[model samples]
Target: MRKRPAEPPVRREPEAPEGCLTVAIRIPVRIVVLVLVVPVRMLWDALVVAGRFLNDALLRPLGRALLWLGRAVFVWPFVALWRWVVVPVGKALGWLGHVLVVVPLVWLYRYVLTPVGHAIAWVARGAGAALGWIAGGVGAALGWVYAALLTPVGYAVMWVLKGLGAVLAALGIGVWTALAWLVKYLVVVPAVWLYTWVLAPVGRAIGWCAKGLVWLVSMAVTGIGTALYWIARILLVLPALAVWRWILTPVGRVLAVIGRELWDALGHAWRVAGHISLAVGRFLGTLFRWIFVEPVRWVYRSVLTPVGHVVRDAVWRPAAEAARSVGRATRQALAAARESVRQARADFRRMLFGEPRRPQPVDRREPSGRETRTLGSSTTALTKD
Candidate 1:
């Protein structure tokens, strides 16, 4: 209650220092801001408040508006400066959204979806292959059963056909054998007989006649040729021969006289030639018999001694045996014939008288057999009367 009590209570807020930046220093409202960076919004609201306050205090609205316009122009650089910060924040937000959405989706596909899908595909393929193999097996089995069922039927049919073929072959062979036998008896022999008896001899007679005619013609031609040759020789050479003979006739007579004179000389030469020829013939014969025949015998023995023994057992001995048998039989027969001839000579007179005891009167009769007929035979038989 003293007089000093009227002093004002001490202020609680700190006083803004001079010369430092302050809110109410009366700066243009456009230069002041509420947000730290967007000064334009705060300054615009502040300017509008200032204009209303001024319009209320004084009537200078136009001057106030001019001042506001001046302040706005001055504050434009600050508003423009905020774009760098805002644009960077917006771009950062957009990139964050892109990473959030795309990264998880790609990670899920790599870590989970791709392997799961491949495994599912592999399982599906394996199942499909299994089904295919089972179906193929069933189909193959069915085809095998079908083939196996038909095989026995085919074999049975083949067996029946084989049996039938064998039976038919046997029957055909039997029929052929019977036919061959019948033909041999009834046809072949008759045909051969007819040909041999009738046609063969006729053909042979015609052939012989033709041969004789040809031989006669050839002989006639040869005779004519010989005659012509003789005539030509006479024409060409007989005159020369006659001339030579006439010229040599005197020489020949002289030579005959010489021969008569030289008969002893020619006789001695002839005797010598004859004796030499006879001696040569005897010597050559002896040499040939001794040398060639003995050597040939030795060569034959050397080459064929074992061969002869082997062949004798194989072939030649049998042939020699047969020849020896024939010779022995012939010798025996000749000896018997000689004995019989001697006996017959000893009884010759008795046999002659004894044979007169009986006589066979000859009564020749004409042939009666049908085989004596003229033409067409199995040509078979000849009858002798």
Candidate 2:
């Protein structure tokens, strides 16, 4: 079996169809004129040129006219506003000018309002007179009605009074009899009943109170006697007791010294413990300050100070720097793309001819051998053997 060439071996253009390619069409002019290429840079260059041309040819004149029109339309209006409205308003507000303006307003007011006020006041006075007459008539009618109604009411009242007087006299007799009976029942009989039924217990209670008072008096007398006896005993024994106590002064001194020493030592010990506790509390407070507050202070200095500075620089300054760098890089990339395109054009020219100045003649010759050469790189050619 024949050996196949290795994969990815150099490729070659297919040979012109067996003998049918004896005649060839001239395609260089077509390729040069009718070819479509992705010339982004060329299009961009054309746009730039067109833009510059448009700015010079069209936009500049348009901008100048627009500026002049704008000056005419807006600038004059802006300039005139202070003079036309603001100055007029300000002048009208001045005292002398305001007084002059007020003259017309006052004249208008007098011409329009004086007659209306007089007419309204006349109508009001007429309405008041009518109302006064109606009020007087109503008053006379009401007075007559009141006098007529009073006679019947007075008669009814007199009749009622006569009946009431007779009934009252009868009731007076009964009331006197009832009052006399009630007085007898309430004062004489009930007093007798209370005296018979309740006074004995009251008297006994009063007697008991008297006995209690006597017993209390007796107890007070005994207490007073005891107090007097104690006072007399103290008066009688105080000197002897003093003498006896004086005799034991030396023994009391020793015992007092011992007791005072014990008390002083206990008091000193308590004071020392209290002082130590206070000092410990103070030291703990200071230690807490050292451990927590000092560290926080140090952390503020070490971290937050630098972090805040960095953040300020990053957020404010570095962002500006990055924007500048990106703009510069974009400009450089555009320049680099232009340079690459120029180099590619130069290379294509070199391949089409030999050099820019001296072009080589093209030959439409058929190659003699079965092997063909193809370009693999700009500097190298590959052959399929």
TM-score of 2: 0.27
lDDT of 1 by residue, 24-94 (tens): 33233222221222434334445766788888877586778878888788766556665777677888988
Query: Cα deviation in Å at residue 71, candidate 2?
Result: 48
lDDT of 2 by residue, 1-385 (tens): 9998778968898985522221222233223322322233335445776799999999999999999999999998988998899888887688666587777778877987887888999999999999999999999999988889977899899999999999999999998999999899889998899988999889999999999999999999999999999998799788778876886786676566556545554455455545655565578779999999999999999999999999988796888899999999999999999999999999998898876566776753434468454454232244322
Pairs in clash, predicted candidate 1:
none
Question: How much is the lDDT of residue 291 in candidate 2?
Answer: 95
TM-score list, all predictions = 0.24, 0.27
Candidate 1 deviant stretches above 4 angstroms? 1-147, 232-385
In model 1, state the lDDT of residue 362.
Answer: 68
Please tell me which predicted candidate would have the highest TM-score against the true structure.
2
lDDT assessment of candidate 2:
0.76
